[model samples]
Target: MVECGAKHLIYVSRSAGKSKDDENFLHELQVHGCRTQTFAEDVADSSLIKKVVQNAAKPIAGVIQMSMILKVQGTWNLHNAIPGKDLDFFVLFSSLSGILGQIGQVNYAAANTFLKAFVQYRYSLGLPASVLDISAMADIGYVSNRPSVLAQLRCAGMQMLKEPDVLDALRLAILRSLPTPSAAYETTSTMATGFHSVSNPAHLATAVATDTSILDDEETSGELLAIQIGKQLLTFMLSTESEEELDLGRAPSDMGVDFLVSIEIRNSWRQSFRSEITVLGILNAHSLKDLGKMAAKNLKEKFERRNEAMK
Candidate 1:
């Protein structure tokens, strides 16, 4: 907006203080003779947001809603308060989790997903709105801080965007609203579609399609494969010198596994075992050992049912 020669800036946040980066940016804006004011207000609260927007000396031209909460009511209230008639554009910062499920972030994803739907709703009412479902931003933010989660994203084939690139994408999204919320930023790649092993394509291909009924030693084969998957998850999520040394009995959370890591683990199972496991079921696993057992059991049941149908 500063680059576009916005004369006055109204910055709002739940926090009272601005970050060093924010202060520097505001200082630069002021130097350029662009009047600026910061409001310590919760955008989710309709009354607070309405009052702040109403009191602006300059007519509010644009709004960028970045407030994140786990509840739908917050979004609903904010949506009601936004002066669609007065704004040129409304940009909502959404996450890729809304499009693709994330472990331990059901509420976050659902909230963001609502924003996507809300954008469509606004368009139907002839209002200008866009939802930017951003990919993981590298070197900053929640996803990049945790090395384990970042590695998991890489393994799942999610691309990371630099800070400048993200800003550029956001600017473009504001200028042009796309038909689909997912297309808000053409540059940001969507979440990884399916799992692939760089070292061994054959490993994934055969394991994913293995016939349980044909194998004479089904139990042994399943157990070995389960153990292999457990080791793979532990290797990515932990600082393990040796995969063999890692205990299979340790819970994923205990191994420093997070929401994204858990999602990658489930994705791996989905592609490897070709079994339809519920997201809840995957996230609820107590340990890698337990998850592996579930995978093996599901794989066995799938083929057994197929064999029975053929008979």
Candidate 2:
């Protein structure tokens, strides 16, 4: 909307603080002839919300609610204060974690789930409500602040949303219109609403499936391939330069592999070998040799289980 020659734009946030990058963002909008003003108010505060609305630019066209607390009651307060239902489009930035509960984040999942349901509720009221259950965004937003968390997410098979795709998705969401026929929007969907993972949409489902093990011998091949996969994963984890000169005898910690790197390895191992090696197991290994042995053990267990089931 900024580039489309919008006359007045009102930005409501908790504070008027601007990082150098944020200032650049506002400047770019102004350069595009979009007169922008920032309002400092807590959206969850009923009085503050009303005050902001009363002081807002005339004819509010849309609302994109992205703020929510990490805990239950606090989140509920914010959700209740979500305004502008009578507007053209209301986009709720939810998360896939709501659908597939994340560890130590029960309150967060519940809160996001509420937002997802709110979209449907608005739809029932004949409002333009869209919920985007987005995954990690690489360069911007909350995920970018903690890159280690992002690495862990990658290990868990979460793909990061690229900037271009995100921009396209946002354009679709806010406009609530059919995608334009352009090279930039070629891959984006016309019906890019409801539940969507910015990266892999089917990933959560795949992770949730019960049929995890490659029970058939033909499917996973055998012990030799499993060993190769283990070695390859360890190589990828510990080596900064190349996988050629892997020090299998050296401990991962000694080789400068940290807890997060070990997580990446564990996730890779799970995906490649269809093994159920915990991150703890990966970290517990004294050396690369020990890690390989753990992987081998997991493979052996799967084979044994499949054989026993057959019997």
lDDT of 2 at 276: 71
Model 1 TM-score relative to the real fold: 0.53
State which candidate has the highest lDDT.
1
* Lowest lDDT block of 10, candidate 1: 187-196
Q: Model-by-model lDDT, in order?
A: 0.63, 0.56
Q: Any residue pairs clashing in model 1, and if so which?
A: none
- What are the C-alpha RMSDs, in order, of all predicted structures? 17.3, 15.6
User: Please, what are the lDDT tens digits per residue for candidate 2 over residues 1-311?
Assistant: 66545688777677643668768888988787787778766665666665666777676676666775622333344335445454766666777787777899988888877776665555555456555666778777777889898889878877677564455455545544112223231212112322333223223213212222221222222222333444555566554544345556666567666677767766767675566777676656676666655554455566567757865
Superposed on all Cα atoms, model 2 deviates from the true structure by an RMSD in Å of 15.6
What are the TM-scores, per candidate, against the unseen true structure?
0.53, 0.53
Residue 277 local lDDT, model 1: 67
lDDT of 2 at 5: 54
Model 2, residue 212: displacement in angstroms?
Answer: 36
Residue-level lDDT tens digits of model 1 in 1-311: 67767899887777634678888877888899898888888766678878876778798887777666623565566568766766777777777788787989888888878887787777766677766777786777777889998999888787676575456545545654423233243321111212223222224234323334222233434444555666667666766546546566667667676777767766766777677666566556676567656766776677668757866
Ten contiguous residues with the weakest lDDT in model 2: 185-194
List clash counts for every candidate, in order.
Answer: 0, 0
